[model samples]
Target chain A: MDEAVSATAGARVPRTERGRRTLRLILDAAAAEFGERGFHEAGISRITQRAGVALGTFYTYFDSKEAVFTALVRDMSMQVRDHVAPRLSGTADAIAAEGAGLEAFIGFARAHKEIYRIIDEAEFVDQASFRTHYQSTVDRIVTRLRRGAARGEVREDIGEVHGWAIVGMNVFLGLRYGVWNEDGAPEEIAGTVNAMLRDGLKP
Target chain B: MDEAVSATAGARVPRTERGRRTLRLILDAAAAEFGERGFHEAGISRITQRAGVALGTFYTYFDSKEAVFTALVRDMSMQVRDHVAPRLSGTADAIAAEGAGLEAFIGFARAHKEIYRIIDEAEFVDQASFRTHYQSTVDRIVTRLRRGAARGEVREDIGEVHGWAIVGMNVFLGLRYGVWNEDGAPEEIAGTVNAMLRDGLKP
Candidate 1:
């Protein structure tokens, strides 16, 4: 990977730990601002104020509001992946790992509900970033399924269809159990899906 | 139903059969216009022009651009329901019916790829409508699951979680097979999902 190319692709690469913290603050604040007021209505000054940074400092990292928003979408996507990864360690099989991932996702979504709005808004705000977010996600799912197939833990034919189907299930389950009602616990919601995933609806 | 209240709820209710036809024309045109230009950029005049109706005629039904967009979302939601409902007629069971529904949906989505973008953008442009669309769809799923449970066709415990899960699966499957790529036939995609729904990922 070209370090300089990657650094220039988004916000300026911070040299120190303090600089990294500042960038993280900006992104968290951007999520709040965009989540609350949406892209067009959200203001950079407000985001800067929320980030506890000076007005000039906002420009040090991000070139414009759109650039920051794009970066934030990428940031949130990684945040999700990172959040779900650790939960898969103790699973008995790849299918169980998927359930763990879903459970963790619902919990994460509950904590960061604005993620849905931010990502959905990306389709309208930055089309390329929006496509990248989903394509990369589906790509990860495909990888997991293929790996499971190798171990004989899942159907050998598990591919794009299964990958998309599982992702879609996790997304809506999170929306319902994580965001909308929270009527069910994450474990309970995830368990229900897991059961369905491992054993079909046949009675 | 209260005719006046229902009429005021959306656009003006078309009176004569000819008026209904014109209303349908305007809605179809609105779909094409909004699908192409998106909500914020799409204009009332362009929608009217595409519908082959005069400018004043547009206001006879829809009050403004936002109003037309809202109506179009609801219309598309209904169109999807109507399109898929008939395919369930001859299914051997509710599970089979669901498979048929998925098949019909993929076909519908492929023919009208913009439905995804339009409904998704509703989250940003019209939050209530977006929530309404998905909630209603999930509600239908819940109803089907409950019916299946009563008939002992599916797990008796299936509820909101299963409903959202299946809905999510259908949606992503449609997006993958219908919108982004058309590599797989509708029957093949639906069959794959059906097998998973029937027997899951178990080898």
Candidate 2:
């Protein structure tokens, strides 16, 4: 079971390893169900069926469809954070880390194409979760940029505006290059963006 | 009626000045209805009421609730483009133009806070309009960047990727600084981002 899945406040915490496995199954199933059918159309029965669990088993973890959807949004948000964190740690500088982070993100988006749908849907379904997902993501970027500034790799005044800019850039890039089509390699796309980030668009 | 409102394929174009006013009233009413209540909860009757028109008058322009929603999305898209085009044209160079454009967008977003909700909801209610809105916006940015490149103001290789990045940055900035809060002045926010775009983040 992923650490991210365990943090969902909407889900009841599992007590044992077996229970954890069951919870994992339900979450993954929820992702597929919500990703395809959306909030209004998705059902708990279909989710349990996809998870290969009984209806009672799903009730043990989540009380309602909305609860599960909320949990799933948190889980996916953490999933993205976890996936990109390690890549950032391995890079040489702030700018290079951004390049690596974007490459990892685009790859993640390609693998979890439903992520966009789920996150975007949260805006209407669970507004708080949607806002938190982006706020936290931007906060993380600010922390990273600040760290880079302390290390003398980034501008000393690096702050929230830059963080939001980078996150937005990565997101739309993921939407276009990762989910919409695969015409550009993730590395090439990241490289182009990194070059722009490292040096402005000016000639 | 605004030129943007006239281009909507879902709504029938008005044949006379009075007809155009009626259509304009319907479209504006739809924006408020869809923006406030969303697609599923919004109703055609409610739209006509808001427009101060009879139910029969709505059918004269729009066939259904979905038709008006689709038209509203396209109208808002063009609204943003039309609002920013002149700002871009008046600037000294591509970079400066982006600053002006971002400032204009943030101001527009502040005035029309519901624009975000309406456009974002289009993702779920009308996928084609949502995608077309972003694609057309990005295409315009790409064209501007190419023109800048030709004049040696922007990098020669600037294309769709850079276009998407700028649009994404402007959008998130508008959401944060425009709709979410007015803590930062539009000029200051745009200037900060413009500096980043004018020069890399390196110390």
Candidate 3:
């Protein structure tokens, strides 16, 4: 977790390492609670209980359920970014980096199936966070594509539409191949999409 | 509306043309009701009020709020299909068909912005309907791709992943360009994506 997200609004920033760990616990517990019960039915007491912390401890980190939920959305969004960023750096080129990013994302989604439910629920629960999640994600893709274009790996005209298109493709692929079922291998799925990205759909 | 969806479970099927008109009014009213107030907050009386019909008339077609919501999901899904299907047929090839389909979908989405809120809410309100909406949409895309491949327009290897990817692309494009803002022209957005589909992101 980074300082920016760790210091989420409505929540006191944890100064100590132990405090950060406790905040992490609360956030993880919140994910499970909110993911299972949704924003309406999920309770702060249950979140604290799941975190194995006193109710006071949860309050110490988050001011309310809505606060924690908002923080959780940011936390999860950051988690995805952090997870994929490292993988991209090690890939061969921009196109290969996207393949790596998609594969990593699918693996992350498989491990944290609750992500889609939580992030998706944000649309109704916290509209700003939901929009931010997608907008920021697409913005990052645009940045990466621009960098790739600079290197002559991506088309010069690549812009926001392409970013949204790629993000949409990755998101649906994650939903189908990750959360819904593991019918296809992540490598194969990523490879197929990467091929489409590398070459047109034309035979 | 077609017979299959018109006869949604938990709704009384209208036999006569007048009955069908009443049913159509109720469904349209339900779309406005659920689209505005959401499922849990929307009421049968309000839907009737919106339809300019009696409460008994509302119940004549739908048994409860859930029933109407489910029907609305199917109705909206069908509306999107019906809107896009005709545009696809007039296109020269499968790829052009996809571009036409996407263009049509974006236009439909702009006209029915409520469709996203209703369909997305189904994930929580009625999981079956939510799954069916995407599954059926993707299935249709797969069938189209298969036909395209048979005609040597689309690559033969195009399958479910590609189907989901394309649907995801169109959906996100719709959300970004159609619902969120009308900053981009639908034709331009569709044309850009169509170009990407016709040729990959490679330089």
Candidate 4:
């Protein structure tokens, strides 16, 4: 099981600027390695080599490859939310609102396809990490929906159930569009998903 | 890319009694192994050993673990259709029809949790295979929905959009309830899903 770190833990203060830079180097290297080779295939030694850090220094921050992956998951989560947060605030009509959310979500997915892949494979690599990240994403979306509902920006009919519905739809789209690249471009698929959400899957 | 079937020609006869028996043995063993260790962890040797077959004999039926997984995916698809066919034929009411479809889908998922894992992991293992299976499942469900709409047993507004929506919902529920055992039993989750489907996701 992947251990959950306090939000600040992954970015814990370094004794020096050099220490901070080294931590970023390690994480960036770890992310690249994991993205290319997958969680199981990416080893600690390789990650250290990629970061140009001492093997012993790697242990100072992360317990193992699983820990690095967990930190990466958390980092990606923050990145995704940061990317979408701006667009999500200050929306217009229902159609525009839905469109903005879908676009923002899909845009983030498009830009960070590797992060999505790593998170997707986390299910097979470690169930705890998968659930943690999955639930956190869902919960974040649900919170947004709740906020919309409160503001009377969303249809009263669409409630928590609708949250799950949107989550389900977006999840499949993310898997198909980014992880699998099953069909059309991420933007094009995002349009279809937005249409379905607004029109109730009617023609 | 994993081979869908072994290169050896006529290694296992299709539709012949002996071939059918061998295929059944291979499929059953694959399912069990996949259930116990997931797709990546389960090996072809373990499956063949459990099935009381030699290594070469295993390849005679399946080119690799993936080939066996492909066969299992196909078989599960057929089983799902069989389970839903009777319900589709019996229902005339739109809400009732949707409920029946949701229940039948969940029932199939519960009964074949291992197969569901293989299908889900297809995202990670082989995107091409994942898309092939995904499109096939979507087409089948869309056909049924179109039939229901023609009979006035489903909302006329529904189309491929709803097809995608329903498929997305089922996949999410199956992963959460059936595969991961996240919160509730499959049957209970099925009821919640059916209700959401029959009625709109309004408050």
**Each predicted complex: what DockQ?**
0.65, 0.58, 0.63, 0.31
- Candidate 3 docks with a DockQ of 0.63
TM-score of chain A, every prediction, order shown = 0.93, 0.94, 0.94, 0.79
* Model 4 per-residue lDDT tens digits across residues B84-126: 7687666645555556766667667667777666766766676
TM-score of every model versus the real structure: 0.93, 0.95, 0.95, 0.79
Question: TM-score of candidate 2 restricted to chain B?
Answer: 0.94
lDDT of 2 at B176: 86
Per-residue lDDT for A1-203 in model 1, tens only? 36333433468877888988898899999999999999989999999999999989989999899989988888888889889999988788887888899999999999999999899888888988877777778888778867877887777777777788888999889887888777878998888789877775222
- The per-model lDDT (C-alpha) reads 0.84, 0.86, 0.87, 0.65
- The chain B TM-scores of all candidates, as shown, are 0.93, 0.94, 0.94, 0.78
User: How well does candidate 3 score on lDDT at residue B89?
Assistant: 87
Residue pairs clashing in model 1 are none
Query: Which window of ten consecutive residues has the lowest lDDT sum in model 4 chain B?
Result: B1-10
Residue B145 CA displacement from its true place in model 1, Å: 3.1
Per-residue alpha-carbon lDDT of model 3 for A1-203, expressed as tens digits?
36564446557888898998998899999999999999999999999899999999988887789999999998899899999999999777788888899999999999999999999999888989899889999999889877888888878888899899999999999999999999989999999899888775222
Candidate 2 off by > 4 Å: A1-6, A200-203, B1-6, B200-203
**lDDT measured at residue B137 in model 3 versus the true structure, 0 to 100:** 92
Worst 10 residues of 2 chain B by lDDT: B194-203
| Tens-digit lDDT track of model 2 for A1-203 | 46644466699888899998998899999999999988889999999999999999999999999999999999999899899999998788888888999999999999999999999999888999988999999998888777878888777888788888888899899988888887788999999889888774222
**Candidate 1: misplaced stretches above 4 Å?**
A1-9, A201-203, B1-9, B200-203
Backbone-clash count (model 2): 0
What TM value does chain A in model 3 reach?
A: 0.94
Q: So what's the TM-score on candidate 4?
A: 0.79
**How many backbone clashes can be found in candidate 4?**
1
